[model samples]
Target chain A: MIENRPLLNLISHLTLCLGVLVVAFPIWIAFVASTHAPEALNSGTVPLWPGDRFLLNYAMALGLETGQKTLNVNLISMLGNSLVMALGITIGKLLISMLAAYAIVFFRFRFRMLSFWLIFITLMLPVEVRIMPTFEVVADLGMLNSYSGLILPLIASATATFLFRQFFLTVPHELIEAARMDGAGPIRFFIDILLPLSRTNLAALFVIMFIYGWNQYLWPLLITTDEHYYTVVMSIQRMLSVGDAEVAWHLVMPSTLMAMLPPVLVVILMQRLFIKGLVETEK
Target chain B: MMSNLSLANIGKTYPNGHQAIHSLNLDVEPGELIVLVGPSGCGKSSLLRMIAGLETITDGELHIGEQQVNRLEPAQRDIAMVFQNYALYPHMSVFDNMAYGLRNRRTPKAQIRQQVESTAEMLQLEQLLERKPRQLSGGQRQRVAMGRAIVRQPKVFLFDEPLSNLDAKLRGQMRIEIKRLQRRLNTTTVYVTHDQTEAMTLADRLVVMNAGRAEQIGSPLDVYHRPQTPFVAGFIGSSSMNFITGRLDHHQLQLGELRIPLKQKVDFNGEVIVGLRPEHLHRGTDYPHRIELDVSLLEQLGADTLVHGKVPGLDQELIVRLKGAAPCEPGTRLSLGFHCDELHLFCANSQQRIN
Candidate 1:
């Protein structure tokens, strides 16, 4: 900037524009595809431009009975299911990770390090690798086809715990001592001091975890057998699995757009806090 | 209200077997400001923390008023501490930060408000009460930290280098402010700082600590003039004391080639280290003890001049403090004198005061 490198600045701008194009192109195609009728997309290389069937395709997607027997499940019900699952996972993970990190960092109980390492080891074993066993446990507990089966297992990851722990460690030891001098016990300190200081981290983690929970496909696919329990992301696959037809590209594309809307809105609205949280938690 | 604090043979040893504080004892009178001064790693902070109930008293008992408070939490000990960093709650308003303790105690809302408002007014933080700590200046934030402690009206006030984070000019101003506030509040206070100036200026009674033990504890002047140990003597004064190793004979002190007779008799006659303060050295030949020096360097401070040089056959460097600016060059010869009463003789082996 001091040297006024116009050429370099131009090059950087061009590179960023290209990156944006690469990411946005798919969503653009999905939008175009969702606006067309089934026959419009079935013919030669799918249409690049919007068609006249926008309301028709979306209406079918949100309809309780789409008139096609195979795709009878309502997109409205699936969206509701996704919202519940995302909120559950985000809140559950934040609470569990925060308390765990606080205990591990502040208290000097026996085997504290061992317990921390044990929780940290869960980072290595992702939910995907332990899917069958997790599913079995969920099934045995009578949680199959329920929201808990879709969310609880995925909430047990170590990423949030580690982030909270790292943030807690960076807090000055003096604050804790001062709080103690103020006569605040552990819970009071957490609510009064620690929680307020961690606002950005919580907001940022919520964004990441909400997206993580919303985009979950394989976990929800494995657990939820009942049509009423299907999340939007997993139910998209159900819509495309119509046996002999050309995969209802119009209906599937609209559902895909709807499925991605909530997380995108969340990220866009809370973008400032999200970036602050991300940068601070990493520190 | 103020209460006396008593520490009976208190000690601290970390879990790794690092003995940070040995069995230390001190008694604080009501409304007294006791300062614990030392170099870092000297366990002054550990001692303060133990008294605040932030650290475990591994060996002995601690008493505040009539209660044995060694097992009590910091809150239960009826103490409030102002940290070096000011430790104002970053997200809370100044009023909330001060009111947090009272709220935790379930104090009535009207009472909490009145106390917080009065403390804020006392610290002159009334206008900044609604501002978060980040919005305030360093000195303002420091006052808020003090307000937080003062609002509690605890039996004891603990300060752990609370002014160390300020600039030098600000530190001096805050030092006076803290002293005035402490006196006005009349609370039994224990302050810890490594700055000798703070220890000297603010302490009603000073405890000079070294390597986990109290080297000497007395009034500021008492500790400065009659230090019980070489460590205390060196640590208390602004300019370090000049020490000359020599042999002590019957009623006489023998330096390299000069034997000066003493005014008083001493018990031990072995080798001893004689300490003389720089200010005690005069430019004229009016004192009973005299020494000549070859000046190697001169530092002319506006009000006083520091003459750094060495005496013949003396291995250690000697410094002389002369009043005002002295027009003297390096490599010049000067004669300095002191009284026998100004001399502090310490045993060579034990570093304990001999007379």
Candidate 2:
């Protein structure tokens, strides 16, 4: 029984490594594809070594892809737009959710339970079921082609509120009492004591919201009809043509890789936050 | 203000209709450490929370230092609390946690540092100031909690079983530390604990509560030696006082085949509980109204023996704490003495102390 301990530890380590590789295979393959030329990719030559075309393909992918009419869709401008949209959603959601969660968790007002239920009820409804209605609502509000239409609906999701509410419930009544005794009115207590105590949840929620914002394709696509409003994912989708003029794997693969940069960087940079946040929350 | 502490007919009924505390009246002299001793669900903590402005009073006046604070937020009460869990803001360093209130009050940064350092030094927490709550020992965390209160230099200090979470040895040690610190600070402190030993050792005055009502408020010795009610006498002592139920036939305590003398004249009771403290039992003296008993169990401590036995027709049992070696053996009758001077008389019907 004792001899198996080292074997168990080894198995765990290897399993974790395998998990990382599995999650990362697509990115690695995409980067490998970017290194090859269009003919090499389409001709079905398996690329084993790093190809010389990486920088060349990157330069082309960084530029606007030329259409049959010779017009172009910008790469960097779309990235900036995507960033603005993501920031809007992430920050807006956090504020609304924090306030809502605080009010739900601590306050003693009328219809408190009812209000919480109303929010909880939203979790049962998928945005896919209401996409048409939501689109009409955005269009009617003249928010089409604007960031608000892209951000607002997504920002008001019940996840953060539910998550933060769970976190605040754990805050000892004594800490709340200590805050009040120290003269930290409700607002002050929420900000100074409760919020600081909730870093783990905040970090985890931030990563979740960031990935959701970055990977956005369908909603941003449905809402923004203009090329100028395209996000990174939207730009990559537009690169594929309907008629099959000639499929260039070189451009498409690099473009897909380019689209993943922000989310990848976010996950790596805030991995510590994301892990700690979720860990603290489990308590 | 009116006085250091006062509560006017305070009460609490939770939303679920759990009546945690009933109409409770209490007053405290300045710098008095009033320990509220009660069993679980007695509403002592709830009453303290109401005074600390953590909970709504539901109905009644809560005054601290002459100011009615029923409407005030916890932070506005000028009071500081040391909780059972310590609640030391686990994420914060000892310095920041202790200095948090001063900073909230907009004390100058230099002043905050000085005050926090001074408080830390007083608690012997200077070396541990850099550590978070998770890093400190339970006793150290308790001290930091005290430091957190002291740095505020608040009008009143409220402790809600702050030492209850510690180990038995640590609890005893911190109990002494807290009493010494309270004396040094001399601020009006109200402490709540269920431990009779704690209530006995630390309080300037004791408030014994039961079933959401204050049963008695007096000095520790006063509550122990001269409890006004049977409940107080029973609740305040470790082994608990025993009461023998009997009728006063011709004003004499009439047990079956046993007649006990009475020093106080009280109404004859149809039913009553007699209480005797273990320390009051003395060996080998006989007088009028001597009773015979058979011993069933004898528990020996280093200092005394607790003789447990049943007398005929008593229905229940009797315990006597005898000093040195006791001559009484199991299933054997030995002569022991009872003096009327040491007898406490209570009304058999109401269970109220008559003597």
Best candidate (score: DockQ)? 1
The DockQ values of the predictions, listed in order, are 0.61, 0.49
Off by over 4 Å in 1: A1-3, A64-71, A281-283
Please list the C-alpha lDDT of all candidates, in the order they appear. 0.90, 0.82
For model 1, residues A1-283, the per-residue Cα lDDT tens digits are 2767899899999999999999999999999999998878888787889999888788787774556432456888889999999999999999999999999999989999999999999899978899889988999999999887888888875899999999999998999988888778899889988998899999999999999999899999888879889999888877877688678888888889988899999999999999998775421
The residue ranges of model 2 lying beyond 4 angstroms of the native Cα positions read: A1-28, A44-49, A64-72, A242-244, A281-283, B1-3, B13-19, B58-60, B267-270, B286-293, B324-335
TM-score of 2: 0.91
Across residues B193-296, which tens digit of lDDT does each residue of candidate 1 receive? 99999999999999999999999999999999899998898888868999899999887899897788888778888999999899999987678777889999
Q: What CA RMSD would you report for each candidate?
A: 1.9, 3.3
Which candidate's TM-score is highest?
1
